[model samples]
Target: MSSFVLVDRPVPEVAVVTLNRPDRMNAMAFDVMVPVRDALVELSNDNSVRAVVLTGAGEGFCSGADQENAGRAPHVEGLGRPGFGLRSLELLEDVVLALRRLHQPVIAAVNGAAIGGGLCLALACDLRIASSTAYFRAAGINNGLTASELGLSFLLPRAVGSTRAADIMLTGRDVGAEEAERIGLVSRVEDPVVDAAVEMGQRIAGFSQPGIELTKRSLHAGMAASSLESYMPSEGLGQLYLRLLTDNFEEATAARKQGRAPQFRDGR
Candidate 1:
């Protein structure tokens, strides 16, 4: 079969990747992670894809790694030998990195449990839209693993500030959808998160592809840009590049006057 991830184009420029294997609560097994990585890379390279929504197949988003296969050797089924000393762990890291490094914006439609590595996956996305039933936890600490694996330590603090991130990570407590929305972990909490995410993705996909991609890159870079002075150079460069190199601004102007959506290439 095709492994645990199901990739589909629900809209012209929006790709929705569903985490299959609802029986395991969409756990990240070796098979699942590898295919997910490949799918993400494929989508990232597709110029027609402008946005992506990552969600679960059933009730849960993802409940971390497969507990049933906890004792299994960290090796791929078909591949001869896994790379690195911590092969499986590093592979999981690659999945998260792929999401962050993707040119298109990714939306995490958190439908249910997002614990341990699952939470890390959501955190890596550009945006998150959670369902009312959704809950987040850093259960790794409670289960004897370090609280801050999979870039959690870096992403959490930047998201909710040091105080909240420290408390959540240290305690390994559950944060419900309401609390998550209040704390800004998710922008919206709706009945069906995927629908909301798709709506947002469609809106984003309507904009100029290069504009959206450049904006995502600039925002990510600005997160570590130290000071406004340091960040302005990158921002200025993007604005200049867009103005001179692309016709998006002119298209936007015409669209605004014409009362219609701007067709990006050649400005229809």
Candidate 2:
């Protein structure tokens, strides 16, 4: 792993991936995000990891693609300008996809400035919690580029509605923590956002592994479902699969009768 990214276990089942470039506001330079993408892939294959929290080390989360010095993107060394641009973007796009495809749910602990690709990074997570001092911006427009990069175009509208997403992206304005929460861009605002995110991760980690994973899948599917009628059956099947293959439901019943929390042992 590069020194640009740090992976730590705040709790046994929760892995926190911190972008460590505090001086650059943890910009999405290739050096920083490549390790970040690799780290998520590593955590995805670790069965013991039930949830992941992504945040930055210092006062900012990520300032988008490094404007001052975007280190060389992997596999772009010999490419022509067009190929180089496409490959570089693909590398960053993979990082966003990695977050969504991870087996465990991901939470963005937005501790400070989440701008441009940074905002997209937060939106890619399954959930987001921000520090009171944190803020967000659609920085691409400000830089004379399209405001859509790294799935921000699709995810932002789904997150805060098309009208609001349009307004924010077109204007390239800063959204404070309170506004972020109010607009549904973040789940809540906390003083120490990373700790709050870890606590949420711990709570989620207590559930049946397959249950949580399936729920995460279903939630994402629900977002893209063409129709409720077609989506209902797949969702129902997931519930039945867990119920029949695991003793989680029975464990819950028994634990309820015993006046204690359920101890789910579904290894899957």
Candidate 3:
């Protein structure tokens, strides 16, 4: 049987993975997390897929972990010291890592509440687009749990700086869609969030696949770089190699002269 994540191809080269548990607010339970990870891995290996859009069914995007299942078996068998919390973290962390490691750019379509680990999932995506009704919260702190689970501490600080991340994590307050966009947490806000993400995915998929893949890698590398100068060599080397080895650049030049769109090579 299929798990809680529903994967489909809505447009050419674009995969949409929707969290299917609306009654539970698409909570990150063990079953959901495993399928989500598997889906991402499958999509990543498919050369036909160039981009992905992740969203939830019904109203909410995801309300973090399903506290109802807190007493379930540990995600890992060896360690019982951290208890149920450790098990939950193991599952949630896997989903977050899968999203981040995906070669294709992922667009998070936050249609409603993205709480706790849900917000972390969005943060892991390359870009985020939310609906006007959407909201975000580090709700775990309010529930007497650590606020930084599922890599939120690392991702939030990088996206909005340490000051904002600290305030959000410490307070566990809700951040509305408008405020989210204003603070650079999200790129766009509209009524139908998934549609906006699909549009963006289409645009991204139209680019040269090799260039897009390399650019994503370079951006992630820049995050860990010590200084601007340190990152430049990586960027410069990638550009030099692409220009000399790939025919896409020459195709682009020819297309520009002819006032037409360049067709990227298949599986590029």
| Cα lDDT, all candidates | 0.88, 0.95, 0.87
Q: Per-residue lDDT of 2-112 in model 3, one digit per residue for the tens?
A: 458999888988899999988899987777777788899989999889999999998999999787873344446666667655666666677888888898999999999
Compare candidates 1 and 2 on lDDT and give the better one.
2
Off by over 4 Å in 3: 1-3, 70-88, 266-268
> How many clashing pairs per prediction, in order?
0, 0, 0
Give the Cα error of residue 76 in candidate 2, in Å: 2.1
Residue-wise C-alpha lDDT for candidate 1, range 1-268, written one tens digit per residue: 2557999888888899999989889888877777888899999999888899999988999899788863333454555444433677778899999999999999999999999999999999999999999999998899998898899999988888899999999999999999999888899898778888989999998877778888999988988888999789889898888788778788889999999988877233
- Itemize residue pairs with steric clashes in candidate 2: none
- lDDT, model 2: 0.95
Q: After superposing candidate 2, which stretches have Cα over 4 Å from the reference?
A: none
Return the candidate ranking by TM-score, descending: 2, 3, 1
Model 2 lDDT tens row, 196-232: 9999999999889999999999999999999999999
Candidate 2: 10-residue stretch with minimal lDDT: 70-79
- On a 0 to 100 scale, what is the lDDT of residue 86 in model 3? 67
TM-score for each model: 0.92, 0.98, 0.93
Ranking by lDDT: 2, 1, 3
